[model samples]
Target: MSPPGATRGQPAARSRRRAARVAAVAAGLLLALLLCEALGWPFLRGPVERAAARATASVVSIEAPFRVRFVFSPQLQAGRIVVAAAHGMALPHLVDAHALRADWRWGDIRRWRDGAPLRLEALRARTLDARLQRLADGRASWQLGQRRAPPAGEAALPRFGLLTLDEGHIEIDDHALALRATVDLSGSEGEGGRGIEARARGQYRGHDLDLRAHATAALPLLDESEQAPALPVRLEGKVGQVVLAFDGRAAALLTGRRLDGTLRMQGPSLAAVGAPLGLALPATPAFELVGRLAHDAGVWHLVAESATVGSSRLTGDFRYDGTREPGRLDGRLGGERLALADLGPAVGAPGTAAAPPPPGAPPPRVLPQREFDLPQLRGMDAEVQVAIAELDFGTEALAPVRQLRARVRLDDAVLRLEALSGVVGGGRVDGWSALDARQTPARWSVDLNFDRVAIDQWIRALRRGGAGDDPRRALLTGVLEGRLVLAGRGRSTAQILGSADGDGRLLLRRGTVSHLLTEAAGIDLAQALGVLVRGDEALPLRCARLEFGVEDGLVVPRVAVIDNRDSTVFVDGRASLADETLALRAQVRPKDFSVLSLRTPVLIGGHFSRPQVGLQASRLVGRAAAAIALGVLAAPLAALLPFVDPGSGDGPDPCTAAPRSAAAAAASAPRR
Candidate 1:
């Protein structure tokens, strides 16, 4: 039989066994808790969402419930994402995405522990839409205005291994830019792992646009070492009628080296590209271009293999450097038979359209009133050389050109046209002009020399609109040479012309002046002598010299003489540029006279808008003897001359190969 003490020992041993089992279970639970902490358990999603909300208070906010799920990886997600704007209004968000999710992969856990790169494997969103704006104050919604913590002292950026986007749409309505697009994204983990590809259909700058791009980088994308593989990239799109394609390899984005690319562009008009950007450029039809692009140290260089603008073909190299203040551009370009009017809009002149005057009042004058934006002029330095075989000016009012060459330099709002030379109206034309705009108002100066140009052609080329028909058109018929020097200060062309002061000279060779001019001016001796032959005859023009001084916006004739062997005529006048008025007196003497023996001076006075002529007998009261001597000499000479000779010349040609004005000769001297 068992003893009573033995039964009590059995029950105590059973209790000990149960106690040990409970202790073992508690130890297992403690181990599991430690693992969850290290792996970032989804149960902590509430804290993660709150931390995110605090970090992005200025840029974004979370409105929907935060939740976490465990799948292939731990994912923290939100139901609604709203971008934060000023005033704490979250209803109209800059960006709105739904079911946004992001997760760190298990593969990155070892790297995180080893101090290697910690990468987020995937970030995803569905039905995203965004808007970007720039205010008149120059503040931009897309730009991070808040100062970013310097990377020098901040933690490194976590690499984004993949991004998957679906049904994404974005609209950007900014002061200077506009875009609307639908975007799609995908990625893979093979040879192109860590690469994301995107396709977009949109409208940009008022043009239909489609774009596809692929980007891939070295394993550790932030590395700058020599062993890093070059980032591979490609872009293709259409902007308006222009089709653009680019294939290139480049340093990573933050490297500041945008280099190594082949670019192609073709379009019906280059203006299509510039118009959307508010750049002033004229139409260029049938344009095509190809170039190699490279950039290093903030300098971009483009070497054009071929380019065509309008009817001209061109080749050149262009460079822009922005590494230093006052960015610079240097280029050399040459073309043949270019339509210069295709570049007219770039001149920045305002259009002309005048309102009609009431009743018989004078016509309204059109003046340039466009505001000059000096900030753009002060931003860069430019040096360019251009050569063209022929430059078509696109109007009979402007001279046709040949062999045009120009060297242009712009520095700090000062523009200099150096070595500007061209052949126009069958003569060599050369000049230099300078415009200084560094001050509140601008100042300008011009010196021009025209050598042996046909006077008839020159007169035909002078435009007649606000200035009225050119009076010289009725008097000029042969080759002439002249010089003009002018200087003024103002912000616009009309103001400058009104304030200008200059000197000018003109020397004419063999030519003829219209008889109607002399008759209408009522010079009696000239009329009788012409009537001795016929009323329809033009007077022989042998030689003439016009020398004038400009001061206070008035052109004052110092010495004006027109002569042939039979008669000599002199004129004194002041033409007002400020008020467009004319005040002039003319005296004519016939070398010979008829029995009538009538002699009188003529007066011409009126606004240039409508000139008037009158006879001034009172002004000739004391010059009878001189008139008699002129009559006697002219009578004999008249018998020798024949009437109805419809040729250009009536006397010996006085024009020479050299410059006729001393001031012009000096101004035309070779530059040092």
Candidate 2:
């Protein structure tokens, strides 16, 4: 009111004072910042290292040349960080990194004030190389809680929304597996879409492996959909010589939930492809697979559209649930013309033909000579039913089988083959078998029943490639019916056979015996019987039956009888599986008598692999004594001679007595 400019001047002075006060505060903040920068005030160095150490369960250190940037935002950059392994000092170095940088943004600070989730802007590392190991004592380096308790919780956990790596590598050595790999990764938003890409080169279990993957998160992470976020992914890889490709959508990659895909795989051999994936296979078979695959939680399922193994084509639906140890495999596999030899190796049999033995060499042992790997049995649990329209053994091997079907179940180191049935050798074969692997070695039991098998066809097939001069070839023709029940405990075929105890029966009905028997028993019996026993053609085999029992590898005959129009023969013998030795006695009785018709009892004795036949002096002498005794009583017993006549022995039928005789033999056999 006194001067008009006075009020304005006073207001201007107040404004200048406020401006000066702001300037002073700004200067003070700048000075404080300078001091902090010099002293490395955030000394985040210690905290960062301790956090890393706690997270890795290891010792950690960061070599300094540390720097902090505060121009536009707070950031820290480091060089040459290392994390020590929790186990195995045998290694020269554990984990190392050339450069590490972390970015901080204002959004994170703002979110912290509102109690929202915290996120990092970026985390970038270059040339990081690390090794994770487990010692023989079961201590692991990559596993958490192995060293000390993580430093009091939440602070040690770093939440990074995005991570980038360049020229990075990691190696893992653990009890279950061994791995090493180089990795490169990048993610960014582009005109096309938001995508993450990764590439890896590695060796797994000594197999070369390569992988490429791309994933696009089509739905926003914060989208308010009740449905889970969908991540569409494409993958291509190779392990050894096997190639694999998959295109799929996953709910979450890390959690591996709700995964659906089409997977394609092809390789020269299943063995090579499955080696790295830990898929157990019996032999190196060429294989191809195309399947619709899915994963839910810990279970993986495959609907196989087409699968091929070797020359067999198969289609099946299979599942593997790895939610627990001794995980389960369930499937039904059906195919056409599966080769038994192809599966023979899985059961500890030779997968290929043996080299021919030298001339005059003894026949190969019946039991397997190769070692059996017992560990292959305890790898998993499975219930698979198999049906093959036909099964083939190579022409040079054995008879073909048809209508083969079986159900196989394996649980807790025990395997059962149930409801096994097939048609082979002109007969129906049915049986069940069980194998128990919980013992130090192993135990096995089997019951095989053969119904009315054509013995002549079996003989032809069995002797197809043998020497033509072999006297046993084509020597018998009959219908054979039998049952074999056996059990044993051992680690190998030989050991099992040595420990075997069983009963076996053979009944030959309405067939002929070849003239080779005449030579086998020596020409004396043939000439004594008649006209060289029906003129060198096979003799009429009226009836023949043999029964035996086994105990501790010894084979003892219960009853052996062979009858023909010309003569009757009986044999008693004991064979040793342990030593492959045999001792047998044969008594021949001619229907008609000539002075030359007097027959000497023949003996068959030697190793099974090299049996020998000759006349036995002791048996011949005993027969002569019996003849003399009969002559002394001939006049007094003339009226009853017809009852004791060898012809009278051939009653209505001899085979009628087979069952009773066989059962008696089995009941009397020594029990272990």
Candidate 3:
């Protein structure tokens, strides 16, 4: 069926052919491997070692820090290095960057200035021991150098460019010591142009500070192919204190040299401490602040959104430039109930002696010599704003003066209070005023307006502190309108004694004089008056020119009542503070003049709150008709009496001589 030889050797031939196929396959694989080796890994021979050695020469010098251990890969390594440990060196020793490995990608060789871009790889080394500086000074000697003089015509040697690790650290201190960032390092190559960039973020020292930041820059020498367009960076940190809490952020365009960002810090409570006046502080007085802050070169600016100072709200803007002995501010401040204490921290006042940035921050920006003067108030450049729901002059008067509130704003040696409304002396006081905080000894003035007020209403209020609780007294109704205008200079209450000269009047209505002038002017116990006067006996006892005095000292008006015709009567003669009584020199002018029996000088001292007066004779006027009836009956009785007399007989108006004579004769025998 088949040829003899073809058929007989067929099996052998198949075997040989299969063997050949296997050999061919092996050859092809070997060829592929060889080709791959040639192109895939170009520097697999002594070339790599040679290149490494050349690259090492490019490093000016490597400073192996203390306690550093470097490890290298056996197959692909430049060289192994180990740093010595630092035992006790006072001069801060940074990073144990001892052991390290690097493969110079591009090397200065056989005049290869113009050619394809050179690249280097496998550029790394690991270390187990790495300890460095705790904190970075924020200032540095750029390892690269100062900006290179601008190229004469451009096309300078491709500016050098690189990215490398600098150092790392972690630390803690009083307020908050910071740790070093994993600073990435970068530099440029070539003449006339140079650039650099580095960035890193981490929790330094494994137990110190928290920080994250990045920076980058480039020199003009960077070849277009190796250059990035821009370098942008951001930084953040946190601060903690017993009385303060803080966190901040900052962002900048590194290459452009422009910065913009914000910072915020907050705490609870603070105290006002200075020479002259001292104040005790409290805890839980929450104070917080958030600022839209920025810094460029040495200039700084801030705008606070909102803050808390002792349960109060504050907001404003602030700015400063450079390290001047006296810094200046152009801003405004406002708050609801904040005190001067709570504002210390925000305004850069000395809050705590120890805090972050070490007392080393060039000493707080010099405070400027700023001043503010307003018609109503005067203050230092350091101004204040205050709002209060209630305040106690801490004196005895109306009980819980209701609806009491006020607002005060101070600035540049000027103090202005727009609203000061409250209940005083049974009347509502609504007004505004100003003070000169800068004037020698400071000057003050206020214009107060009073509203229609009830006397008994005030009396009852005062009575609460007195011993009299009379029911009839409760029925009393009276209104008083008055003015209290005064101006003077005084730093304290003691100064106000003689510093002020002012006048005030009391207008009365629908009330009895006994109620108003009971303690002031000795008056009719039962007469009601349409009006009355006050002020006099104490000072000059003038209805209009009433004067007051100071004892320990409190300025009090001498009691006097001036009638509508300006007729003034002394209620209490030369009265003075007598413990709790308005001692009156007994002088009584009664409805029906009654001579004094108490003494030539009666002491009419009693709680003016309520005085007892008895006049039963005056009440008799209510029964005038009864007395008239009795008088009428007595007239007729007189006629009968005359007739009964006989001798003086009462006959009809006729000539009574005869009758009289007869009567007289009858009377002569009329012994009976």
lDDT of each residue in 380-472, candidate 1, tens digit only? 788889787877765565556788888878887798888988887678788999888886678878998889876666556332231145534
Score candidate 1 by lDDT. 0.60
lDDT of model 3 at position 448: 72
**By lDDT, who's the top model here?**
2
Clashes per prediction? 6, 0, 41
Q: Candidate 2: which stretches are off by over 4 Å? A: 1-126, 131-166, 173-318, 350-364, 395-397, 456-479, 510-543, 562-569, 584-608, 611-649, 658-672
Model 3 scores a TM of 0.37
Which scores greater on lDDT, model 2 or model 3? 2
In the order shown, what is each candidate's alpha-carbon RMSD?
A: 10.7, 8.8, 23.7
Cα lDDT tens digits, model 2, 237-298, are 88778898889876533224466889898887655654664544455356789988897766
The positional error of residue 241 in candidate 3, measured at the CA in angstroms, is 10
Against the true structure, what is each candidate's TM-score?
Answer: 0.60, 0.65, 0.37
**Which is superior by TM-score, 1 or 2?**
2
Question: Which residue pairs collide in model 1, if any?
Answer: 591-630, 591-633, 591-634, 592-631, 592-634, 592-635
lDDT of 2: 0.64
Alpha carbon RMSD to native, model 2: 8.8
